[model samples]
Target: MGRRYDRLIGSLVGTCAAFAASPAAAATAGAPHLDGAEMGLIWVVPFVAILLSIALFPLFAPEFWHHHFGKVAAACAAAFLVPFLVVHGVSLTIYEVVHVSLLEYLPFIILLLALFTVAGGIRLRGSIIGTPAVNTGFLLFGTLLASWTGTTGAAMLLIRPVIRANEWRRYKVHTIVFFIFLVANIGGSLTPLGDPPLFLGFLKGVSFFWPTQHMFLPMVVAATVLLAVYFAIDSTLFRREAPRPSDEASEETFGIDGKINILLLAGIVGAVLLSGIWKPGIAFDIYHVQLELQGLVRDVLLLLITFLSWKLTSRENREANGFSWFPIIEVGKLFAGIFLTIIPAIAILKAGTGGALGSVVSLVTNDAGEPVDTMYFWLTGLLSSFLDNAPTYLVFFNTAGGDPAALMGPFASTLLAISAGAVFMGANTYIGNAPNFMVKAIAEERGIAMPSFFGYMLWSVGILIPIFVLITFLFFH
Candidate 1:
């Protein structure tokens, strides 16, 4: 764990790096700056409780959770807000709320909504045989498609097609499991729109293509290996399974419905890219939070694009695709709590050794005080595997140094570690990423006896972990 330390310190010297920032210099730089150093660990309890509730409630109380999850989220959010308002005053509370909501949560959910809406409308209408090669092709194509369509969108779009192809086979659990690993999680690494955590990075000032540039190699490496492995396993399973009966074979030609949504998806991409590249320089203040014209335009355009896609597509297309609003609604409600509760966690991590999460700093740093890339990878990843990855990513991003310029420069590797960890390790569990559970639920609905929570981990633990180790050696190490 001992590093030369100079590299880390050098990284810190750049543009207010997060963890490396001097206690005086960093201190969570922002308006009405929250002094994380002054806040006790108790302040973090709500964040922890909310994440735990997300992880636990569905397992223990599916009925109550299904009906009342939104209320639970609001209660957890109030757990922090009520206390903060009382202690910090209405003005500061309002600023924090407005800042986070306007800058982070709103853009995030909007982007997800646009992608989900657009991709949901486009339905694959034809049938294809699920040979080993065809199955591998589905996975690889979804992996490629995920960066443009959000993981949720990509997974939702292709999963049914993949399942339909494989339904004739008796043994295809491995195919679905690998589908979760690649299409739902790892595939989203290449672009901000691909994953929530990366989008948070983009919102924080990481360029739209920063991930594409820096993350491409690692993504390609992991994807190549996983795809190769999937091909081998799938081929073996295909051999073992009995041949499809003549009646079960696909007689339908492959086609797609709602093809116009493809253009709309492009529109969504253009809107997001415009927000990043076009700085109109005009801005407005909303309760101490600065809102830019470009961002405003981007959001409005996204909403318009969502409207156009929904209006243009037939209800029949979405119904055939088995599209439902529940997944996105669940994400919106749950992440509302996540984004709110994570405020202090980000602040504390930004405060470094001076904050409640000081030990976190120690764990990811060497004795010489350099950031350890490997530890960052594992910790961020393992945490993301269990807790929600987006917040797990934000915590580590601030911990490294919240400054985008510095992180993109000297601490680039650290940011890469955090990014890869959050996106990749999300495949480790059903709850790790939003799409994981959705994909699992969909598979079960299709009559696949998907692994139980722990049962699924057997696939992840046996396959994904070793791949992660190779990734560490290839990049993070």
Candidate 2:
């Protein structure tokens, strides 16, 4: 499957090159500005196709998908690029590719890679049982750590231990699902370091502690509710499952190997902060995309840290942790396609009332042009659930008027809604955030029977949706 997909990609690339070199195609050389208002909804077919591929392919054709998933991603990217190049010309196509790759995809993948590699090196060497109290404590610790180490970092670091602790239990799927909800998603709402959306907000002139100030109560309420609910469900499941002979000796010892990786994790966090704070303003232009010095420095440092972690940690540590590269690789390939196909969708949303999706823009505004906070909450969240949350947050942040001072002041609730929606609702689906997929991959690799894509949505819709509704009235409204 992999080879077949590679051949198809090669053929597509050859065709594109030949077409571009043709006299007629060469004549259409200049870049044309794209107006989302003029674009028909049909342009979104590739995006929808890619999304469906992510959702349905795994369920319908497991073997084919497992092998050729990257190829499917590449095909979906080409589906958009080919027509896009024909319509918008070579210059704009090049710009779009470079723009998304340099500005969005590279940094995103690098951060995740660093976190995954560093966290994978750390193994908790302990004989802890997965009692209800122990499980709840692990979840709570992960939830707190997420704000500091990032959702990806925290999830990667703790997921293995959680799975190991509960390896004896038969009904343990709920524990993993709740882990996705709380540790991988909601737990990252407190600080800019917690989630990508908030970090993007920070880079867009929001203060470092702004999210802490605005999102604290909502985050506390959401996490507390989730933790309480998870405890109840897990306790019941625990009672149903018969205890193993090993469970008779309840006392257990706990220690951590690969402790140096914890410092590397801190280095990762510091590197991110340095990029935001120490902007040198120097940039190199690559095909019209500006690669800033600070960002490049951060990426390089992250790579270095990843290498150091790999070299320092023993092979036994990774083996014990059940660490593998498949999870990160899967995330990297799938998101490459997602970032590319999402370009037009973002442009349409950016076009506001003038764009193809004007009605969507209108949903957050009342007849008097007043910003409706509740609508902002739901719309931003619903979109973030499908679209990548960081960019979605930025879109609504700009839509609500992009002045940080204004947003933090008069439109405080609006900003809060956008922040909460992007971070909180990312739990709604597997692809809603990067870590969500990584956690799912790791859990499945550990032999846990994860739900189908739609099955997981049922869990989110049933659990998270109601909590969000309550939040809408209690806060955003």
Candidate 3:
């Protein structure tokens, strides 16, 4: 009789334990599908836009047909294409958490301010270096400079000079492709501010110093390889253009008269600092209010800065440089298609997390059967070359968190993969990096014929991919 009663009590406790565990496992299960849904939208929107733009761009601007349309148009098409599809397809969960509110939009505004400041700074100096021998120098210097001034600043400062130097050359496409690889992509590996992924890591628990210190060797190696490779390719192209009579006259000095634009730029930076220091309080009820206030002030200041930069700069300088709103306008025209198309894909990623992903995501095991964190940085880096590096970084960034024990692994090694992958792989295609589009637009505005979308990838897949694999093996593994 006593044994029977004890068995009844044991069964009751087991039932209660099962009930408690069920809710947690259930919550974890629902997360992955939701993630997939969210990411799926990113892909869908851009694809639709690609179809629409093929019809729309020519209809709207028939004159665009007469000059080289394939380069800029294909690039713009990609700016709308790759990021939208890849982000939509990844099934990341972060967006799901912030989906209901405007806080998710905060980063976009920050990017806008940051990008504008970068653009404004570019407008000031234009390009300082000319090419062939100096082209590789610009690439190396720009990569180092990216760590401090931001990749956008480095890209903007160097692009014009590179373009001008190669302006007389027929084979300018290789120059821009290498520029995207080094200046736009691998250059940002050192700092959080340098790349969005490291910045996101900063917002999480990772230290700023950690990534920079660990990444230095790889950065130096990659920069050196890229410079050597760029010089070789550039030399070959240079010889081809050289046999023909040089139509281009070298400019002695190109000077800027608009110094006040610098002050306006300082104001934009000040606005960002102000917002950071005076973050709004977030109560459950009023969470978005703070984000709204900060965003409004940030954007308003950007508007003022844009106006002042335009107003203070001399008209002759603008025309002499052939400066127009075309670059910005081009960026604006193309990203709308990207933004609209990727929304649904992100939804799918959010909806499908954990439920469908468990089989696909697992640890690498040693011969002894000890589990290790999978080498995600490799594939994530590769995918980033095709997708928008930011969302690609986020999806894998979250995925790397599975076993708490994994954090005990080398911080430098792990974050190196994540940071390096995101920054470096951005050069995989023209659209992989934000500055790639801006640089391409700037080049085309100056009348250089850049490559088509696939053409740019051919350069990357052929040259950059092998270098990245060497990097991963030498350092990351």
Candidate 4:
């Protein structure tokens, strides 16, 4: 244990030391940034390693994973940073690290933490049966709720209730899988409030109602198909399982405890909306990274909300809900690794036809450079299924010509492709979006084996890919 602790500390020190070596170099001439055009494919290996680690370790080495997953995360982060430090030197490395940590990672985790805390406090009290109708209704409600409260908010709020509803069922993995599909991912397509990527678009001058106007049809198609399919699978499983005597015998009433948290969830939505709408036009410069006043306000407000929710709810309040901080901690640590290591990948993709993945960039256009909406959809989606969907959306948004009016008018279909791809295909993997991981963790905590990472992909690849293909034919093509 001591050695493991020492190793973890070493990993942390190594990663941090590189970034800290030259704080005063923020104004270094030439801007000292990573030229993704010069970087090769090797820079992305660390990101791939972490993905494989998350997928394989739990399945093949559960004991080691449960014991030292944080250390593994730290080591993977170091593997990326230490090498980049050697190649780029401390100045550029520090700039890139601070850039992402402050502007991207911090905001990402803060929003998630706020939603998780507030949602965890809202305990649904009842012996809701695991009947097909009940489970389907829960998912439908969560899907509708996601676009308003945020996917993290919706998923965190109802995952426990949904799990509690189905605890008695033997064939229940399918329910959680479909919940991820419709509720956590596809459901977030209606507005910027729905998901981080859409919110990023909102910040980038995409109109508030743009997603609602354009993405509504695609979101409806995906949700309706998945919900219907989930209902059928669950119904068949419901009939196959041996019915317990108390399944229908108990006349349990449904109710909610810690009802105040319902209001806090709304506060969360307001705080996020305020960040987008109530821009105060002030800024803070943290080591050359620009921090806007509205952003800081949103983050602080969210933290305060999280604290209030914790204090307002009693210990028993959350205990009854089976709410634990483990899921959030697990997501925070693993995503810290994911975000840090993915720096190069985002940079490379952002470089367009000059980076190592130029062939990928070239695919979205033809010899005449016309925007092929179909390729935009598939590429953005396939990349988003692995990379952080927010930046992936930004990359393709810029690729489609970053002028909002033009994209919203002349290139409307192209913008729709990018938006739908990022928002919907996030359901393609547990790591594809923040909420997916949280939902998986919470479900597993309730003793659902869920699926192994690749095992889960089997579900996504078999189920979601076809849906996306159908969407392509119906819309993008």
Off by over 4 Å in 1: 1-30
The lowest-lDDT stretch of 10 consecutive residues in candidate 3 is 7-16
Q: Write the per-residue lDDT of candidate 3 for residues 1-477, one digit (tens) a residue.
A: 111111010000000001011111122333333334223233445434443443333335535522333344455446644563465444432333232123322333344444444344343344343457877777787787666545665676567767766665677777787787777767877765566555445433355555678778888888889888889887877776655344445445665455565566556556655544554743222311222455457557767776666666667755544444433433333333333333443333333334334332453223453323226666667656555565555555544542212532543455567667777777776556567755766777788787777777777778877887788678756
Q: What is the lDDT of candidate 1?
A: 0.79
Give each model's whole-structure lDDT. 0.79, 0.74, 0.52, 0.73
Best by TM-score: 1
Tens-digit lDDT track of model 1 for 369-395: 788999999999999888777878878
User: Please, what is the TM-score per model?
Assistant: 0.93, 0.83, 0.64, 0.82
Clashing pairs in 1: 17-401, 18-401, 19-400
lDDT of 3: 0.52
> Mind giving the per-residue lDDT tens digits that candidate 2 earns over 127-157?
7789889999999998898887778767767
lDDT (0-100) at residue 469 of candidate 1? Answer: 97
Q: Indicate the residue-level lDDT of 292 in model 4.
A: 79
Using lDDT, give the best candidate's number: 1
lDDT of 2: 0.74
Taking every candidate in turn, the Cα RMSD to the unseen true structure, in Å, is: 7.4, 7.1, 14.8, 6.0
Residue pairs in collision within model 2? none
Residue clash pairs of candidate 4 = none
